[model samples]
Target: MKKWLYVLGISGSLILTGCNGNAEDTNAETENQAEEKTEEVNEQQVKKEILKAQMELTNTFKPYQQKITAYQAAVSAEEPDSETIQSTGKEAKTAASEAASKVEDFTIEADLPEDVNTAFNDSLPSLQAYYEHVESALNENLEEADFTSAEEKFTEFNNQFNEIIEKAGFPAAPDLMEEMS
Candidate 1:
Protein backbone atom coordinates (compact mmCIF):
# COMPACT_ATOMS: atom_id res chain seq x y z
CA MET A 1 0.00 0.00 0.00
CA LYS A 2 2.81 2.42 0.91
CA LYS A 3 4.59 1.61 -2.40
CA TRP A 4 1.37 2.33 -4.33
CA LEU A 5 0.92 5.69 -2.51
CA TYR A 6 4.54 6.68 -3.27
CA VAL A 7 4.11 5.87 -7.02
CA LEU A 8 0.85 7.90 -7.14
CA GLY A 9 2.63 10.97 -5.64
CA ILE A 10 5.48 10.66 -8.24
CA SER A 11 3.02 10.47 -11.13
CA GLY A 12 1.13 13.56 -9.88
CA SER A 13 4.37 15.55 -9.65
CA LEU A 14 5.35 14.63 -13.24
CA ILE A 15 1.92 15.57 -14.55
CA LEU A 16 2.04 18.99 -12.87
CA THR A 17 5.53 19.65 -14.25
CA GLY A 18 4.45 18.75 -17.80
CA CYS A 19 1.41 21.02 -17.57
CA ASN A 20 3.57 23.91 -16.33
CA GLY A 21 6.00 23.49 -19.25
CA ASN A 22 3.22 23.55 -21.77
CA ALA A 23 1.66 26.62 -20.14
CA GLU A 24 4.94 28.52 -20.35
CA ASP A 25 5.27 27.72 -24.06
CA THR A 26 1.69 28.84 -24.69
CA ASN A 27 2.30 32.10 -22.85
CA ALA A 28 5.44 32.80 -24.87
CA GLU A 29 3.63 32.22 -28.14
CA THR A 30 0.78 34.50 -27.11
CA GLU A 31 3.27 37.27 -26.29
CA ASN A 32 4.98 36.89 -29.68
CA GLN A 33 1.67 37.09 -31.55
CA ALA A 34 0.63 40.17 -29.60
CA GLU A 35 3.87 41.90 -30.44
CA GLU A 36 3.52 41.09 -34.14
CA LYS A 37 -0.03 42.45 -34.17
CA THR A 38 1.13 45.70 -32.59
CA GLU A 39 3.84 46.21 -35.20
CA GLU A 40 1.41 45.60 -38.06
CA VAL A 41 -1.06 48.05 -36.58
CA ASN A 42 1.62 50.72 -36.28
CA GLU A 43 2.71 50.27 -39.89
CA GLN A 44 -0.86 50.52 -41.11
CA GLN A 45 -1.38 53.63 -39.01
CA VAL A 46 1.65 55.32 -40.51
CA LYS A 47 0.44 54.60 -44.03
CA LYS A 48 -3.02 55.92 -43.22
CA GLU A 49 -1.60 59.12 -41.80
CA ILE A 50 0.46 59.75 -44.91
CA LEU A 51 -2.48 59.08 -47.20
CA LYS A 52 -4.69 61.46 -45.24
CA ALA A 53 -2.14 64.25 -45.42
CA GLN A 54 -1.73 63.76 -49.15
CA MET A 55 -5.48 63.92 -49.73
CA GLU A 56 -5.83 67.09 -47.68
CA LEU A 57 -3.07 68.84 -49.57
CA THR A 58 -4.57 67.73 -52.86
CA ASN A 59 -8.00 68.97 -51.91
CA THR A 60 -6.63 72.39 -50.93
CA PHE A 61 -4.99 72.85 -54.33
CA LYS A 62 -7.75 71.34 -56.48
CA PRO A 63 -9.54 74.63 -57.10
CA TYR A 64 -6.33 76.40 -58.05
CA GLN A 65 -5.58 73.58 -60.45
CA GLN A 66 -8.98 74.00 -62.08
CA LYS A 67 -8.42 77.73 -62.48
CA ILE A 68 -5.05 77.12 -64.10
CA THR A 69 -6.66 74.61 -66.44
CA ALA A 70 -9.24 77.16 -67.48
CA TYR A 71 -6.52 79.73 -68.07
CA GLN A 72 -4.57 77.25 -70.18
CA ALA A 73 -7.64 76.48 -72.27
CA ALA A 74 -8.34 80.17 -72.75
CA VAL A 75 -4.81 80.84 -73.94
CA SER A 76 -4.87 77.86 -76.31
CA ALA A 77 -7.63 79.28 -78.49
CA GLU A 78 -6.92 80.34 -82.12
CA GLU A 79 -7.31 84.06 -81.36
CA PRO A 80 -6.58 84.46 -77.65
CA ASP A 81 -7.84 87.79 -76.42
CA SER A 82 -5.46 89.95 -74.39
CA GLU A 83 -8.29 91.05 -72.10
CA THR A 84 -9.31 87.46 -71.40
CA ILE A 85 -5.73 86.52 -70.77
CA GLN A 86 -5.34 89.33 -68.27
CA SER A 87 -8.52 88.45 -66.40
CA THR A 88 -7.79 84.73 -66.38
CA GLY A 89 -4.22 85.34 -65.34
CA LYS A 90 -5.41 87.44 -62.44
CA GLU A 91 -7.86 84.74 -61.45
CA ALA A 92 -5.21 82.06 -61.65
CA LYS A 93 -2.81 84.15 -59.57
CA THR A 94 -5.43 84.66 -56.89
CA ALA A 95 -6.19 80.96 -56.81
CA ALA A 96 -2.50 80.14 -56.56
CA SER A 97 -2.10 82.60 -53.72
CA GLU A 98 -5.03 81.05 -51.88
CA ALA A 99 -3.67 77.56 -52.38
CA ALA A 100 -0.25 78.64 -51.17
CA SER A 101 -1.70 80.23 -48.08
CA LYS A 102 -3.66 77.07 -47.35
CA VAL A 103 -0.49 75.02 -47.75
CA GLU A 104 1.41 77.41 -45.52
CA ASP A 105 -1.18 76.94 -42.82
CA PHE A 106 -1.42 73.20 -43.27
CA THR A 107 -1.01 71.06 -40.18
CA ILE A 108 -0.18 67.41 -39.65
CA GLU A 109 -1.04 65.14 -36.81
CA ALA A 110 1.72 64.71 -34.25
CA ASP A 111 1.33 60.98 -34.11
CA LEU A 112 2.53 60.48 -37.69
CA PRO A 113 5.84 58.74 -38.28
CA GLU A 114 8.90 61.00 -38.16
CA ASP A 115 9.94 60.29 -41.74
CA VAL A 116 6.51 61.16 -43.09
CA ASN A 117 6.43 64.32 -41.02
CA THR A 118 9.87 65.29 -42.24
CA ALA A 119 8.90 64.71 -45.87
CA PHE A 120 5.84 66.92 -45.48
CA ASN A 121 7.66 69.66 -43.62
CA ASP A 122 10.56 69.69 -46.02
CA SER A 123 8.26 69.99 -49.03
CA LEU A 124 6.45 73.11 -47.77
CA PRO A 125 9.16 75.56 -48.77
CA SER A 126 9.42 74.15 -52.28
CA LEU A 127 5.66 74.25 -52.63
CA GLN A 128 5.54 77.89 -51.56
CA ALA A 129 8.37 78.77 -53.91
CA TYR A 130 6.64 77.05 -56.78
CA TYR A 131 3.42 78.94 -56.11
CA GLU A 132 5.26 82.24 -55.86
CA HIS A 133 7.04 81.56 -59.14
CA VAL A 134 3.74 80.74 -60.85
CA GLU A 135 2.13 83.87 -59.47
CA SER A 136 5.00 86.02 -60.72
CA ALA A 137 5.01 84.38 -64.14
CA LEU A 138 1.27 84.80 -64.46
CA ASN A 139 1.69 88.53 -63.76
CA GLU A 140 4.20 88.91 -66.59
CA ASN A 141 3.41 90.20 -70.07
CA LEU A 142 1.60 87.38 -71.93
CA GLU A 143 4.04 87.59 -74.86
CA GLU A 144 7.05 87.23 -72.56
CA ALA A 145 5.27 84.35 -70.83
CA ASP A 146 5.28 82.47 -74.15
CA PHE A 147 9.08 82.80 -74.33
CA THR A 148 9.97 79.59 -72.36
CA SER A 149 10.24 81.04 -68.83
CA ALA A 150 6.63 80.19 -67.99
CA GLU A 151 7.06 76.68 -69.25
CA GLU A 152 10.18 76.30 -67.15
CA LYS A 153 8.33 77.47 -64.06
CA PHE A 154 5.48 75.06 -64.80
CA THR A 155 7.95 72.19 -65.17
CA GLU A 156 9.73 73.11 -61.96
CA PHE A 157 6.44 73.28 -60.09
CA ASN A 158 5.39 69.90 -61.45
CA ASN A 159 8.69 68.37 -60.43
CA GLN A 160 8.52 69.77 -56.91
CA PHE A 161 4.92 68.68 -56.46
CA ASN A 162 5.78 65.22 -57.70
CA GLU A 163 8.72 65.07 -55.32
CA ILE A 164 6.49 65.75 -52.36
CA ILE A 165 3.94 63.13 -53.44
CA GLU A 166 6.61 60.55 -54.10
CA LYS A 167 8.29 61.08 -50.77
CA ALA A 168 5.01 60.46 -49.03
CA GLY A 169 4.23 57.41 -51.20
CA PHE A 170 1.23 59.16 -52.68
CA PRO A 171 -0.01 59.40 -56.24
CA ALA A 172 1.33 62.24 -58.39
CA ALA A 173 -0.73 65.35 -58.79
CA PRO A 174 -2.76 65.47 -62.01
CA ASP A 175 -1.16 67.59 -64.76
CA LEU A 176 -4.06 69.85 -65.52
CA MET A 177 -2.08 71.99 -67.96
CA GLU A 178 -1.34 68.98 -70.10
CA GLU A 179 -4.96 67.95 -70.07
CA MET A 180 -6.29 71.42 -70.84
CA SER A 181 -3.71 72.24 -73.48
Candidate 2:
Protein backbone atom coordinates (compact mmCIF):
# COMPACT_ATOMS: atom_id res chain seq x y z
CA MET A 1 0.00 0.00 0.00
CA LYS A 2 2.87 2.38 0.64
CA LYS A 3 4.30 1.55 -2.80
CA TRP A 4 0.90 2.18 -4.35
CA LEU A 5 0.64 5.65 -2.66
CA TYR A 6 4.13 6.57 -3.81
CA VAL A 7 3.28 5.63 -7.42
CA LEU A 8 0.05 7.69 -7.35
CA GLY A 9 1.84 10.77 -6.02
CA ILE A 10 4.53 10.50 -8.69
CA SER A 11 1.90 10.13 -11.45
CA GLY A 12 0.00 13.22 -10.25
CA SER A 13 3.20 15.27 -10.16
CA LEU A 14 4.01 14.20 -13.76
CA ILE A 15 0.56 15.24 -14.96
CA LEU A 16 0.87 18.67 -13.35
CA THR A 17 4.27 19.15 -14.93
CA GLY A 18 2.88 18.26 -18.34
CA CYS A 19 0.01 20.74 -17.92
CA ASN A 20 2.42 23.54 -16.99
CA GLY A 21 4.63 22.84 -20.03
CA ASN A 22 1.63 22.92 -22.35
CA ALA A 23 0.51 26.29 -20.96
CA GLU A 24 3.96 27.75 -21.53
CA ASP A 25 4.04 26.45 -25.08
CA THR A 26 0.67 28.07 -25.80
CA ASN A 27 1.82 31.42 -24.36
CA ALA A 28 4.97 31.33 -26.50
CA GLU A 29 3.00 30.71 -29.66
CA THR A 30 0.64 33.59 -28.86
CA GLU A 31 3.55 35.93 -28.33
CA ASN A 32 5.11 34.96 -31.65
CA GLN A 33 1.83 35.59 -33.45
CA ALA A 34 1.52 39.01 -31.83
CA GLU A 35 5.02 39.93 -32.93
CA GLU A 36 4.30 38.97 -36.50
CA LYS A 37 1.14 41.08 -36.50
CA THR A 38 3.02 44.08 -35.20
CA GLU A 39 5.68 43.69 -37.87
CA GLU A 40 3.04 43.68 -40.61
CA VAL A 41 1.46 46.83 -39.22
CA ASN A 42 4.80 48.59 -39.16
CA GLU A 43 5.55 47.63 -42.74
CA GLN A 44 2.20 49.06 -43.86
CA GLN A 45 2.93 52.30 -42.08
CA VAL A 46 6.27 52.59 -43.84
CA LYS A 47 4.63 52.12 -47.20
CA LYS A 48 2.15 54.87 -46.41
CA GLU A 49 4.92 57.28 -45.52
CA ILE A 50 6.81 56.49 -48.70
CA LEU A 51 3.74 57.12 -50.85
CA LYS A 52 3.04 60.41 -49.09
CA ALA A 53 6.56 61.64 -49.74
CA GLN A 54 6.35 60.63 -53.39
CA MET A 55 3.08 62.52 -53.86
CA GLU A 56 4.52 65.66 -52.33
CA LEU A 57 7.49 65.48 -54.68
CA THR A 58 5.19 65.14 -57.64
CA ASN A 59 3.18 68.16 -56.52
CA THR A 60 6.33 70.24 -56.17
CA PHE A 61 7.30 69.57 -59.80
CA LYS A 62 4.18 71.29 -61.06
CA PRO A 63 5.15 74.83 -60.11
CA TYR A 64 8.63 74.51 -61.59
CA GLN A 65 7.08 73.22 -64.82
CA GLN A 66 4.61 76.11 -64.91
CA LYS A 67 7.43 78.60 -64.67
CA ILE A 68 9.18 76.97 -67.60
CA THR A 69 5.98 77.01 -69.62
CA ALA A 70 5.49 80.70 -68.94
CA TYR A 71 9.04 81.40 -70.01
CA GLN A 72 8.52 79.47 -73.24
CA ALA A 73 5.33 81.42 -73.97
CA ALA A 74 7.14 84.69 -73.49
CA VAL A 75 9.95 83.64 -75.84
CA SER A 76 7.57 82.39 -78.52
CA ALA A 77 5.48 85.58 -78.53
CA GLU A 78 8.47 87.73 -79.50
CA GLU A 79 12.05 87.06 -80.39
CA PRO A 80 13.54 88.57 -77.25
CA ASP A 81 17.22 89.51 -77.19
CA SER A 82 19.28 86.35 -77.50
CA GLU A 83 21.05 87.02 -74.22
CA THR A 84 17.82 87.71 -72.30
CA ILE A 85 16.04 84.54 -73.53
CA GLN A 86 19.08 82.40 -72.82
CA SER A 87 19.41 83.81 -69.29
CA THR A 88 15.73 83.20 -68.54
CA GLY A 89 15.96 79.69 -69.93
CA LYS A 90 19.04 79.01 -67.83
CA GLU A 91 17.26 80.18 -64.67
CA ALA A 92 14.22 78.06 -65.46
CA LYS A 93 16.34 74.99 -66.13
CA THR A 94 18.24 75.47 -62.89
CA ALA A 95 15.01 75.61 -60.91
CA ALA A 96 13.68 72.46 -62.58
CA SER A 97 16.94 70.67 -61.92
CA GLU A 98 16.73 71.58 -58.25
CA ALA A 99 13.17 70.29 -58.10
CA ALA A 100 14.26 67.01 -59.65
CA SER A 101 17.04 66.66 -57.13
CA LYS A 102 14.56 67.19 -54.30
CA VAL A 103 12.31 64.50 -55.76
CA GLU A 104 15.23 62.10 -55.91
CA ASP A 105 15.90 62.77 -52.23
CA PHE A 106 12.31 62.00 -51.28
CA THR A 107 12.99 58.34 -50.71
CA ILE A 108 11.76 56.16 -47.84
CA GLU A 109 13.98 53.65 -46.10
CA ALA A 110 11.20 51.13 -45.72
CA ASP A 111 10.52 48.19 -48.00
CA LEU A 112 7.98 49.53 -50.42
CA PRO A 113 5.37 47.46 -52.21
CA GLU A 114 6.78 45.98 -55.40
CA ASP A 115 4.25 47.67 -57.65
CA VAL A 116 4.73 51.04 -56.01
CA ASN A 117 8.48 50.82 -56.26
CA THR A 118 8.25 49.79 -59.89
CA ALA A 119 5.95 52.68 -60.69
CA PHE A 120 8.23 55.09 -58.92
CA ASN A 121 11.33 53.75 -60.64
CA ASP A 122 9.66 53.89 -64.03
CA SER A 123 8.90 57.57 -63.60
CA LEU A 124 12.53 58.45 -62.85
CA PRO A 125 13.78 57.97 -66.38
CA SER A 126 11.06 60.25 -67.64
CA LEU A 127 12.20 62.91 -65.21
CA GLN A 128 15.78 62.51 -66.35
CA ALA A 129 14.79 62.73 -70.00
CA TYR A 130 12.77 65.87 -69.36
CA TYR A 131 15.75 67.42 -67.62
CA GLU A 132 18.01 66.64 -70.57
CA HIS A 133 15.50 68.11 -73.03
CA VAL A 134 15.16 71.28 -70.98
CA GLU A 135 18.89 71.59 -70.62
CA SER A 136 19.35 71.29 -74.38
CA ALA A 137 16.70 73.94 -75.00
CA LEU A 138 18.33 76.28 -72.51
CA ASN A 139 21.79 75.85 -73.97
CA GLU A 140 20.70 76.72 -77.48
CA ASN A 141 21.77 80.16 -78.75
CA LEU A 142 18.63 81.93 -80.00
CA GLU A 143 20.13 84.48 -82.39
CA GLU A 144 17.78 86.29 -84.81
CA ALA A 145 18.68 83.72 -87.39
CA ASP A 146 18.00 80.74 -85.09
CA PHE A 147 15.07 82.18 -83.08
CA THR A 148 12.42 80.21 -85.01
CA SER A 149 14.31 76.95 -84.62
CA ALA A 150 14.89 77.65 -80.94
CA GLU A 151 11.19 78.30 -80.43
CA GLU A 152 10.37 74.97 -82.06
CA LYS A 153 12.86 73.16 -79.84
CA PHE A 154 11.49 74.87 -76.76
CA THR A 155 7.95 73.81 -77.68
CA GLU A 156 9.13 70.25 -78.13
CA PHE A 157 10.79 70.36 -74.73
CA ASN A 158 7.57 71.58 -73.13
CA ASN A 159 5.64 68.69 -74.68
CA GLN A 160 8.16 66.21 -73.27
CA PHE A 161 7.91 67.86 -69.89
CA ASN A 162 4.13 67.46 -69.97
CA GLU A 163 4.53 63.82 -70.87
CA ILE A 164 6.86 63.28 -67.95
CA ILE A 165 4.37 64.80 -65.52
CA GLU A 166 1.66 62.57 -66.96
CA LYS A 167 3.81 59.47 -66.62
CA ALA A 168 4.62 60.39 -63.05
CA GLY A 169 0.90 60.41 -62.22
CA PHE A 170 0.95 64.17 -61.76
CA PRO A 171 -1.39 66.79 -63.16
CA ALA A 172 -0.42 69.26 -65.88
CA ALA A 173 1.17 72.56 -64.78
CA PRO A 174 -1.91 74.65 -65.56
CA ASP A 175 -4.19 72.30 -63.67
CA LEU A 176 -1.92 72.32 -60.65
CA MET A 177 -1.82 76.12 -60.71
CA GLU A 178 -5.61 76.24 -60.86
CA GLU A 179 -5.89 73.83 -57.97
CA MET A 180 -3.46 75.91 -55.93
CA SER A 181 -5.43 79.08 -56.56
Candidate 3:
Protein backbone atom coordinates (compact mmCIF):
# COMPACT_ATOMS: atom_id res chain seq x y z
CA MET A 1 0.00 0.00 0.00
CA LYS A 2 2.85 2.44 0.82
CA LYS A 3 4.57 1.63 -2.44
CA TRP A 4 1.39 2.40 -4.40
CA LEU A 5 0.97 5.66 -2.51
CA TYR A 6 4.49 6.74 -3.29
CA VAL A 7 4.04 5.90 -6.98
CA LEU A 8 0.82 7.99 -7.18
CA GLY A 9 2.54 10.98 -5.55
CA ILE A 10 5.41 10.96 -8.05
CA SER A 11 3.01 10.61 -10.98
CA GLY A 12 0.97 13.59 -9.78
CA SER A 13 4.10 15.67 -9.42
CA LEU A 14 5.19 14.94 -12.97
CA ILE A 15 1.73 15.87 -14.37
CA LEU A 16 1.74 19.19 -12.52
CA THR A 17 5.20 19.99 -13.83
CA GLY A 18 4.14 19.28 -17.40
CA CYS A 19 1.08 21.50 -17.05
CA ASN A 20 3.18 24.35 -15.71
CA GLY A 21 5.60 24.09 -18.59
CA ASN A 22 2.77 24.21 -21.09
CA ALA A 23 1.28 27.27 -19.46
CA GLU A 24 4.59 29.08 -19.57
CA ASP A 25 4.98 28.29 -23.24
CA THR A 26 1.50 29.59 -23.99
CA ASN A 27 2.21 32.84 -22.15
CA ALA A 28 5.44 33.39 -24.02
CA GLU A 29 3.74 32.94 -27.38
CA THR A 30 0.98 35.38 -26.40
CA GLU A 31 3.55 38.01 -25.43
CA ASN A 32 5.37 37.66 -28.71
CA GLN A 33 2.15 38.05 -30.69
CA ALA A 34 1.23 41.16 -28.74
CA GLU A 35 4.59 42.72 -29.46
CA GLU A 36 4.24 42.04 -33.20
CA LYS A 37 0.78 43.62 -33.24
CA THR A 38 2.08 46.72 -31.53
CA GLU A 39 4.80 47.06 -34.15
CA GLU A 40 2.25 46.82 -36.96
CA VAL A 41 0.14 49.56 -35.41
CA ASN A 42 3.15 51.81 -35.09
CA GLU A 43 3.98 51.32 -38.77
CA GLN A 44 0.44 52.22 -39.80
CA GLN A 45 0.59 55.40 -37.78
CA VAL A 46 3.77 56.42 -39.51
CA LYS A 47 2.21 55.91 -42.91
CA LYS A 48 -0.68 58.15 -41.93
CA GLU A 49 1.68 60.91 -40.91
CA ILE A 50 3.54 60.70 -44.18
CA LEU A 51 0.32 60.85 -46.16
CA LYS A 52 -0.82 63.94 -44.28
CA ALA A 53 2.43 65.75 -44.95
CA GLN A 54 2.23 64.94 -48.64
CA MET A 55 -1.29 66.29 -48.84
CA GLU A 56 -0.34 69.55 -47.20
CA LEU A 57 2.60 70.02 -49.52
CA THR A 58 0.36 69.39 -52.54
CA ASN A 59 -2.26 71.81 -51.28
CA THR A 60 0.31 74.56 -50.91
CA PHE A 61 1.42 74.05 -54.48
CA LYS A 62 -2.11 74.52 -55.86
CA PRO A 63 -2.44 78.12 -54.79
CA TYR A 64 0.96 78.96 -56.17
CA GLN A 65 0.02 77.36 -59.47
CA GLN A 66 -3.21 79.34 -59.59
CA LYS A 67 -1.32 82.58 -59.07
CA ILE A 68 1.07 81.71 -61.85
CA THR A 69 -1.85 80.99 -64.17
CA ALA A 70 -3.43 84.35 -63.42
CA TYR A 71 -0.18 86.16 -64.04
CA GLN A 72 0.25 84.37 -67.33
CA ALA A 73 -3.22 85.38 -68.44
CA ALA A 74 -2.55 89.00 -67.56
CA VAL A 75 0.67 89.00 -69.51
CA SER A 76 -1.04 87.47 -72.51
CA ALA A 77 -3.74 90.15 -72.61
CA GLU A 78 -1.44 93.18 -72.49
CA GLU A 79 1.63 91.97 -74.41
CA PRO A 80 3.98 93.22 -71.67
CA ASP A 81 7.66 94.00 -72.40
CA SER A 82 10.34 91.42 -71.62
CA GLU A 83 11.62 93.24 -68.53
CA THR A 84 8.17 93.86 -67.06
CA ILE A 85 6.98 90.30 -67.72
CA GLN A 86 10.24 88.87 -66.42
CA SER A 87 9.95 90.88 -63.21
CA THR A 88 6.45 89.61 -62.54
CA GLY A 89 7.52 86.10 -63.41
CA LYS A 90 10.43 86.34 -61.02
CA GLU A 91 8.08 87.37 -58.23
CA ALA A 92 5.82 84.40 -58.90
CA LYS A 93 8.79 82.06 -59.04
CA THR A 94 10.06 83.41 -55.75
CA ALA A 95 6.72 82.77 -54.10
CA ALA A 96 6.58 79.24 -55.46
CA SER A 97 10.17 78.57 -54.37
CA GLU A 98 9.42 79.77 -50.86
CA ALA A 99 6.39 77.51 -50.65
CA ALA A 100 8.45 74.57 -51.88
CA SER A 101 11.06 75.26 -49.22
CA LYS A 102 8.35 75.26 -46.58
CA VAL A 103 7.16 71.90 -47.84
CA GLU A 104 10.70 70.58 -47.56
CA ASP A 105 10.82 71.72 -43.94
CA PHE A 106 7.71 69.75 -43.01
CA THR A 107 8.76 67.07 -40.52
CA ILE A 108 7.26 63.61 -40.08
CA GLU A 109 7.18 61.93 -36.71
CA ALA A 110 7.09 58.48 -38.23
CA ASP A 111 8.89 56.50 -40.88
CA LEU A 112 7.57 56.91 -44.42
CA PRO A 113 6.99 53.97 -46.69
CA GLU A 114 9.88 53.57 -49.12
CA ASP A 115 7.73 53.86 -52.24
CA VAL A 116 5.99 56.99 -51.04
CA ASN A 117 9.23 58.60 -49.99
CA THR A 118 10.79 57.90 -53.36
CA ALA A 119 7.81 59.39 -55.18
CA PHE A 120 7.90 62.51 -53.04
CA ASN A 121 11.62 62.99 -53.52
CA ASP A 122 11.20 62.68 -57.26
CA SER A 123 8.47 65.33 -57.28
CA LEU A 124 10.73 68.08 -55.98
CA PRO A 125 13.12 67.95 -58.88
CA SER A 126 10.29 67.84 -61.42
CA LEU A 127 8.68 70.83 -59.77
CA GLN A 128 11.93 72.71 -59.86
CA ALA A 129 12.35 71.94 -63.55
CA TYR A 130 8.82 73.15 -64.33
CA TYR A 131 9.45 76.38 -62.45
CA GLU A 132 12.59 77.01 -64.42
CA HIS A 133 10.80 76.43 -67.70
CA VAL A 134 8.01 78.79 -66.72
CA GLU A 135 10.48 81.47 -65.72
CA SER A 136 12.26 81.21 -69.03
CA ALA A 137 9.00 81.48 -70.96
CA LEU A 138 7.90 84.48 -68.94
CA ASN A 139 11.15 86.35 -69.52
CA GLU A 140 10.36 86.76 -73.21
CA ASN A 141 8.34 89.71 -74.60
CA LEU A 142 4.78 88.65 -75.28
CA GLU A 143 4.65 90.70 -78.51
CA GLU A 144 7.97 89.40 -79.80
CA ALA A 145 7.29 85.76 -78.84
CA ASP A 146 4.44 83.35 -79.32
CA PHE A 147 1.84 83.83 -76.61
CA THR A 148 0.34 80.45 -77.45
CA SER A 149 3.68 78.78 -76.85
CA ALA A 150 3.98 80.34 -73.43
CA GLU A 151 0.47 79.24 -72.53
CA GLU A 152 1.24 75.71 -73.62
CA LYS A 153 4.33 75.58 -71.42
CA PHE A 154 2.33 76.86 -68.46
CA THR A 155 -0.30 74.20 -69.08
CA GLU A 156 2.35 71.49 -69.15
CA PHE A 157 3.82 72.64 -65.87
CA ASN A 158 0.39 72.73 -64.27
CA ASN A 159 -0.28 69.19 -65.46
CA GLN A 160 2.98 67.94 -63.97
CA PHE A 161 2.15 69.58 -60.68
CA ASN A 162 -1.27 67.93 -60.63
CA GLU A 163 0.32 64.58 -61.43
CA ILE A 164 2.47 64.78 -58.34
CA ILE A 165 -0.61 65.48 -56.27
CA GLU A 166 -2.35 62.48 -57.76
CA LYS A 167 0.58 60.13 -57.20
CA ALA A 168 0.69 61.14 -53.55
CA GLY A 169 -2.90 59.83 -53.19
CA PHE A 170 -4.20 63.16 -52.05
CA PRO A 171 -7.92 63.77 -52.21
CA ALA A 172 -9.26 66.65 -54.21
CA ALA A 173 -9.91 69.88 -52.37
CA PRO A 174 -13.27 69.78 -50.62
CA ASP A 175 -16.07 71.28 -52.58
CA LEU A 176 -17.73 74.27 -50.88
CA MET A 177 -20.90 73.60 -52.85
CA GLU A 178 -22.25 71.17 -50.31
CA GLU A 179 -21.54 73.51 -47.42
CA MET A 180 -23.23 76.37 -49.16
CA SER A 181 -26.26 74.28 -49.97
Model number with the top TM-score: 1
Better of 2 and 3 by TM-score: 3
lDDT: which candidate is best?
1
Q: What digit string (tens of lDDT, one per residue) describes model 2 on residues 39-65?
A: 878666654655564456447666776
Encode model 1's per-residue lDDT on 1-181: one tens digit a residue: 9999999999999999999999999999999999999988887776677667656666667778678656766788799987887778788888767766876887765467776677667666656665666667677754234325545655665565466556545555545345323
TM-score of each: 0.68, 0.48, 0.52
The CA lDDT at 142 in model 2 is: 28
C-alpha-based local distance difference test score of model 1: 0.68
Residue 53 in candidate 2, Cα distance off native in Å: 1.4
What's the TM for model 2? 0.48
CA lDDT of 165 in candidate 2? 44
Alpha-carbon runs more than 4 Å astray in model 2 = 66-133, 141-181
The segments of candidate 3 whose C-alpha lies over 4 angstroms from its true place after superposition are 69-123, 140-181
Write the number of the candidate with greater lDDT, choosing between 1 and 2.
1
